[model samples]
Target: MSTLRIYISNQCPSCATAIHRVHFVRRLRPEQSVELINLDHQDTVRPSYVFGTPTYCLGNQIIFLGNPSEGELLSKLDQPLSSVKQIT
Candidate 1:
């Protein structure tokens, strides 16, 4: 499955929003795989230090920050995997 990591804390509103949005997308597009990584958990935080409540990483490359957006997620569905980050 393609990696879609979401770093979030359960207590955060943004994280909750992101989770719901991700679930919506998952239901709509069953073909895609979405993984929710809880930032509060020690295991997840070590691999990815999420300063903010909600952060999205598409295959180890962060594509979005802050609150989640359905439109933004859909827009990048077709983008090729980048080398984590793009300087531009």
Candidate 2:
């Protein structure tokens, strides 16, 4: 298992898209843990490099910079996951 942290901002469409990707991954792998951090409420240590909302970080490394298809997202996540099942 890995730490899947998603930074989101309220009232942002891109944020919603990112959320969808997280849920999609979670659906396929229920054992994985996911955390949704609100940028509005949390002081992310580093926000400069990330392009925009919907940024995804697997553990302490960024796996995705923008909203990507569930497939692409899964591949990055798979790199750190101990177990994962593919879902269409």
Candidate 3:
């Protein structure tokens, strides 16, 4: 029941790839809850820890700072949140 939050910005070239990766995860894990946060939007509030675009966070912890391989993303999603380490 954990949610995955993807923080993206319109200016980032790799954000699209990260968005696609989220879709890929959704297709494979339909039960997982994923939220996409676009920093470019004025209503969206950027998290203090997120210094760059295409950041993926599971709960409050950042899992990846940029676009990650589909396999790596899936692997992290499959593991317990406590065991998953932050990836840059």
Identify the leading candidate in terms of TM-score: 3
Per-residue CA lDDT of model 3 for 1-88, tens digit only, reads 6799999999999998988987898899999999999999999998788999899999888989888899999988989987866544
| TM-scores of all predicted structures | 0.77, 0.73, 0.92
Tell me how many residue pairs clash in candidate 1. 0
Model 2: per-residue Cα lDDT at residue 23 = 80
Off by over 4 Å in 2: 42-51, 80-88
Error of 3 at 24 (Å): 0.4
lDDT of 2 by residue, 1-88 (tens): 6688888878667888877777887799788789887777756564565556777877656667677788887777667443333222
Between candidates 2 and 3, the lDDT winner:
3
Among residues 3 or more apart in sequence or in different chains, the pairs in candidate 2 whose N, CA or C atoms overlap within 3 Å are: none
Estimate every model's Cα lDDT from 0 to 1: 0.72, 0.71, 0.89
Better of 1 and 2 by TM-score: 1
The full ranking of all candidates by TM-score, starting with the best, is: 3, 1, 2
